[model samples]
Target: MATLRQTITNALLMTAVVSMATPVTAQDCATPGQWLTPGNQHAEAQPPMGWDRLARQRVVLLGEQHDQAAHHRWQLSTITALHSRQADMAIGLEMLPRKVQPALDQWVAGELDESQLLDRTQWYRYWGRDAERYLPILRFARDHRLPLIALNVTPEQRRELSDPASHQWTLDQRHGVPVPLAASARYRQRLMESFEQHSSEQLSSHISEAFIRAQLVWDSSMAAALANASHQHSLVVAILGLGHVQYADGVPHQLTRYGISDVTGLMPMAAADACLAPTGVADALFIAEPDAPSADTPRLGINVERTPQPLGPDRLVITAISPDSPAQYAGLEEGDQVVAIAGHEVRDTAQVRALMARSLPGSLIPVEVLRAGERRQQLVTLPSPSP
Candidate 1:
């Protein structure tokens, strides 16, 4: 019997990244005409000539850091620019799992409001990392009547993919596309680095294998979804993490397994985890400056519900504590009235937002909440993902 790794390698070699002119070599990808501007810098400036070439391609990918507000800004700018050029396109989002496609459809069709859409998609639970960052782009899609495709695996599917005992091979091979591929030496090294940062445990070979498989599931699923949605020569603007769109080895490479060929990958030049090896980041780069995050950035790390008929803008009540979140560690409880955060009096959601904008994740927060009509003060430790 073939080993799982052998099976994966064989499936990958069979579909080698493309049937196009050729797999874009390291040197061939970053031609003068392919490099684009940064997300923050592109707002006031005209897109470079390279963008024109990319816009003409079958699929264009814009990579971002999920919590980076400016990346979403740049994505919207690029999408609107392409639309202005009369390009027929649809946007794919990694935030929404495929199960929420109906919510996406309803949102774009103007049948659902923001709160309702987020609720219907289980946004806070499944995608609770942060939705505010992408809200503007979602609104943009709805306002422009653009198609939005939910390009992600459901939580259940994620579990299935991560479990070595789960039989996903047959399903993965169902459409003759293999989700697992040979990890490039660079990719493997980077994966280990990321793993080490978040885990105190040793990076055992078996643990590493499971982690890589999970990553493959995300990459391959998005690639397949984009390929299916691109029928009729429509352009696809994929908004996803920089990691998945950085190297051609991610979604772009997965696309070639279906023989779809034409793909242009671009990443924000400001990404912290940029693939520095000549060809790893993307086909080209989008230049953008990082935005200075506000103090009221809401790093208190709790999902909040506004108190009914609030006394002020900061009169928010805690609804839930995100597991492993700072709020959870701070002993915040449901129905706790958020009276102050970081010593700032917040009477409502807006005030809380303002206060959080001024704070950074991992910063010490002195929070005072009215729980059971008694005031309690707690210190919160924000969990910020490393840039």
Candidate 2:
């Protein structure tokens, strides 16, 4: 029998968008077997089938692209279907932190409104400008009184996991030590490969090592939490970014290491067609689009106006520069139009930020300016960005 992962991959490969010109009838989506073939080996496989069996799985890890609304919709639908069977289910989310668990729990228990549950800054990062796609999931969890566990690793831990040399050093030197493990010859070769893939560099070696180590710690913690849950709970679903849940070395593998062999990983197929394949820990996957994409473009701090022209795309504008920053030290004033950055056209704020973000401290970046209808170039030594 094909694994649930394989089945999800097949379903995603065969997905077609519903159209208003040719409306999709109920028969088209009733179930995979009714409209699509089961294990059909031909070019055109079937849609998702076996919902009844899938609903019975003990643990379901619903992998998602943070920005996709359609994936969220499909996730809600799948969860609702499983709920109808009266399966005891809990949702683990990556957006919130473990420290905020009490607040999250209180919100889920109908003690808080949406605003209290998700503040503006937090909401913007997770949902972006599309509040519609995210609000429903929060509502559903609240209505069901399901527990919402925060599964993301802390920022300090994330920094630690991104480093590599610390993995070779003393355990005390590590910021957050991974659960100690005796050498398992079975995993020795894989461990070597992991080490090789995540080598540290002069500037970034520590950070990279820390990041990997943190992942190990996080996976172990998550698995332990899941395994310790009441057996009466039929399913535990974890919602996380694709990066953390994609590879065999990711959380699912860590879960297996902790003795939870019976686990299923699912990802939204629409985000990346390749994720549907059962290459690593992902057991089952589905792909779906968001209801709509967000239209708000990100804004940058700088604006420019060209000399002798009121407004034009090339008329660069400098909205704001960091206080006591290199640009400020170089006599760059707000509303002083940027003629160029190192002789390149100042098209928009994005280019400016990108150039600045990558600049090393004390590196001289040439800035051409149009101030009071005068053109001048200044060499500014950039300061290091704060950690």
Candidate 3:
């Protein structure tokens, strides 16, 4: 079986990180256009040549590298520009799942403040990336009274779809998510290359098939949400991770299946990759300098959620762990229930963040976890702070 990091990297390979090209080899992707600007330095001063093209589309997707504050800023600026010409618009978010959409609606209706929305949505529990980076965009939507549409399926839904055995469920039982259209031959080959990039065998057909199924489930779910929301609003602008928008193979392809064809995808390209961008990566690209790591908060590079225990209060279970992270290096795997950190019991992600933030780099923090009903202990060595 492929590791979680390998799976994630395979998914990300189709994202804006590599311009969603065929493969990473230098020979596969074509060179980027020289006429386009590279970074956000001049973004406010002047819009790109095809800026109006985005406003004309019924749906415009703005892609981002989830952790990059600069990408968010670019998205905000692009959104501000699009809203000027188009008054009737709704913003779709991939961050919050459909279940928490009521919270989003309440936020837009002026019934909730920032803290209230965060609490109601369980923002930290669901989307553990820095909420501060996304608050500005959320505030913009709220202030303008723009309809905020949740464009993602629940984690539970994704888990069900990942299991091939669960194919017995009908469309109604699958929460109305259609059976994903078969992936294009080209798209499948690209995904196959992604799996190979993760040090897996070059011909791992089973892993590729599973990975493609997972990707299809996500793309189709979000596409269905956006397609339905687009009918009510003149324009729907979706803020999603680059992977979903890249090369128009993911969500875009799925959207066409839903009869929503007038769409555009705008991806933010790092300045360093300006010349390396592949053709047709996105409808538009904004050059932005990459953001530096956060100095204020230390990271364990793990996403966790609180799980109700039949016998105990609640357990913090690791949902995902980033590749090459301190947690991964320490042998922490997903499904491990975090018991304690630094001798302090951890009940929530916020507490874990607080404890991790206070510890200096290189400090060996003792961690206790429960794996498969067995208690295990590990010490995580934090990497030195980014220079």
Candidate 4:
């Protein structure tokens, strides 16, 4: 059996050489000339031209990298272009969950402003600052009165599904609920494999497991949302991460499994590259290149120095401390500043993580912290490796 690392390497290699041989039809909108603006700095200069053809299909999945501002801008532009062409519904967002679904629905119904719609913590948890990128899509959805579906798994449900032992039980519960069989099986198997491969005693097993479970929940949620929207609208658009939207095994693949076969997946090409390629069930794919940065921006964060920086008012601050984690067990709290680790001065988040990674599980590491302007030292023993 191939190892997970080997599998990933092979997949990436295959992705590199697989040329999209099918010629885009004239009616198909794979060309860049249709959607992209010339010399547009805010938007991609050469956006995937053929999305109009893809948009005509039953479902159009737009894959995007999360932090790429250009990709988000292009996504908004694509939605606008499709709407102008009379597309009806937009479904399956990775960021919005059922808990906040009502807010999204309200926004689409023009009952709430875009800011008011997504301002809740429940909607912003996984999104962070990247939520700003979706502003345009939110505006479009609200302006057009198009139905916006919330397609994300809730936190509690995600935790339940990530455990391999709970798979059968979860399946039994969600059965007959329009959940795609193939998609669920694939997710459970992949998540189990990922857990076994990446997990060890040193790190929190539940943390990693929860992350994977969240993905499975997100997938199932998106599928359900898509099925419902297809019944109400002819052309449904799904905006999600490139990973969730790419490959034959993603949301589109699950849609095909459920017998919803008509779909197209569009992804923006890196500015350095051209030519769009088909992903799994997608009949059409388009690529676009955005503009380059005006000047080189130096990357931030710590520089590796054997000696740590002096503990001062600018000491490294703790943004979060996982519950039941070593930091938490040691009584570390958010807003605490790390003055020293294992008697060595610590400078930043990177250094703190590095120190933790190097320490063996069960070893006691002395941590000096400043909490509420009071200096305190504590000895924290790392937990056993998580299965």
Candidate 5:
């Protein structure tokens, strides 16, 4: 009944209203549950391309930023997906030393419960990260009766290899680990850059060599473990730090020397990184939405490193303090030795973190710092850590 001009105007008005009401989709790379190639190319044509590639590989490495809950979630989901297709799969973990293999075996065999397994593995002593973040993966392996492989060397072995003196040791004295393959030039350069970023300028200059060797030893040990596991299982999935998986230069490099070439590496990228094109960091990157900040997670906001002294004990030194943090508010400064936290004597940064994890939000904990030969105690109010 309306004129042609009026009908056309109404249709245009409706189209504009509908478009406005519809949600604007996020960029494809940033979209949750999507997979992007190492070159940041969309793999939408084959939704299962990532999974198919993983299924065909002998080893799959899933990397994570230790503190990011979202990274861990992606790892579990990927593991779950791979496991559904590969029942003969095994999981290799960098969280536990080879000394705890018995514990892992017992855990999967239903001989030990969660707490008992942690105790036997000395979880708090070696791995100080939140155990809850990794427990779900362990539980999955247990429920499915999959073998959990311990892929890390003992801390003592790591320390021995980190020293320049270990370079002279024979095969027998090297704790059964072979001499590591020479690092690629790119790998060495990346390690140097990382060392500078994490260490103080003075510490960086003096300890760079040792630090680089330590990382190499870590990579070599894990690769050896994975190689051994690969021979026994249809597939092996390795969960480790992102540094070891990125660019395939860390563990992947060592794996090749161990005769493992069918390896794929995957990592989770934050949505904020969606705009940047990737470059061979991993085989595929999953876009993970950042987790909502937790109000209950206590944060002290300080960077610390344990320096082994020739004397009584290792000193836990504050290397940097975040601005407006509890450490800064409580007058803690760089070079201040953290003698105690929550009234307990602390020997390493791990112990400090363990002690802090016990406190709740709004709790006032006492911290003792020795500054220039003077011991001072301050009460610090804990706050939620930034997401």
Candidate 6:
């Protein structure tokens, strides 16, 4: 089975757009699967407290991959459901920096157009440029007059934290706010393990420390904002990245330390594979209708790291060949300058990728390369990408 982490990433980072036009009803979503520890048993005939229990909590965290359209739909629906039950709630967003809180206020007050709201917030610079993607949630907030709070430190603050001099408590602390809490030992270790996945650079103490520092401050700040907003009879719902909601390792941990005791975490699990043996991932793993999975891109099955050729026109050279790959079988080797395929010039890796997307398995690709100062050509069969 795919890990919960991988499943969420696939939904979040897939290349194809799974567009959503309207909010998804709870009826439209997959019934959430419970992730219980092995040997744990419930005494009640009925299952545990569901969304209503969540509504009664002081703080409710709806974790999302942010880029997934369906995740946004789930968020909107959940917020609407909570509102219908007369839950006094305000939503904090991970997208905008605290500097743009006024812009959010103006928009919620109906003083700004969608285009103007994005501009005032400097959307692409701070969050992202896709305003239409979040219109559903924004519209809901405006319609209901719910507070839309900005939930991040400024970009300048982020840059300062990255500086070596900013490590001191006084230099980094936000005025009047508590200093950001350090991540627990387990959280730091997990963060480093994740950092190692996408980073090609050799892991070093410095890299890990810097990344952990930034992440702690991020989670801590968001946690502080949510805690402050959580007043008597008020429930604060935070929309955040999936990584920040794992177990009690993230925002929940920080909030707990700050004395916000009652917090619940909910993760969305798409409908097709909703029910499974408990992974013990969160309070609940609900599902949304999956977007159409994107068509697989054809591959040459090569692990060649691209290197830039700088003397003249920018070009790419193969740093290495993947084992058991078409390129290796066809005699492509390290340090070979990739020149073309099937008479089309290979200006860069993107061109090759574009070509491969059109190729089928068993299709012969005539690859040209410069190896050991001499030009050579080989006909290599394309391969299907791994499932």
Q: Would you give me the overall lDDT of model 6?
A: 0.66
Stretches of model 2 off by over 4 angstroms after superposition? 1-49, 120-132, 160-208, 230-232, 271-281, 289-387
Query: Per-residue lDDT for 246-288 in model 3, tens only?
Result: 6788899999987888998877765445445656767656667
Model 4, which residues run further than 4 Å from truth?
Answer: 1-53, 164-214, 271-285, 290-387
Displacement of the residue 206 alpha carbon in candidate 5, Å: 5.3
Compare candidates 2 and 3 on lDDT and give the better one.
Answer: 3
lDDT of 4 by residue, 181-234 (tens): 344454444444544444343335555444444454556667767877788887
How do the residues 225-277 of candidate 6 rate in per-residue lDDT, one tens digit apiece?
78878863478888887677766678898897678878887766554333431
Model 2, 1-387: lDDT tens digits are 124223322222222211001332222222221212211212122224355655676666666665566677767876777777655788776555455677777888888876556542243332223445556877888898877776554544544543555457564454324453332342333333334433332324443333334445555555545654525477777766554454434556666645766566655553223222323434444535334543233222344433346454356577677765566778888988787776655444444544454456556778888788899888776654344
lDDT of 3: 0.76
Candidate 4 — which pairs collide? 29-50, 30-50, 31-49, 31-50, 32-49, 201-385, 201-386, 269-288
Q: List the residue pairs that clash in candidate 6.
A: 269-286, 269-287
Please, what is the TM-score per model?
A: 0.66, 0.54, 0.71, 0.56, 0.71, 0.63
Residues 1-387 of candidate 5: C-alpha lDDT, one tens digit per residue: 124223322221122122112232445445767767755555442233557677778999998777778888888988898987888999999888988899999999999998678768877667767677899999999999999999988767877876778778986687656667777787777666555444433543445566667778888889989999999999999999877887888889999887789999887765445335457767777777667664565878888888877777668888999999988998889998888888776665665666676678778899898899899998898874455
Model 4 scores worst on lDDT over the 10 consecutive residues at 295-304
List CA RMSD, all candidates: 10.2, 14.7, 7.6, 13.0, 15.5, 11.8
Please say which candidate is ahead in TM-score: 1 or 2. 1
Clashing pairs in 3: 15-243, 38-287, 39-287
Predicted structure 2, TM vs. truth: 0.54
Question: Given candidate 5, what's the lDDT at residue 304?
Answer: 83
lDDT of 1 by residue, 246-322 (tens): 56777887787778778877766433212122444466565454677644344666777766553433357888777
Full candidate order by lDDT, most accurate first: 3, 5, 1, 6, 4, 2
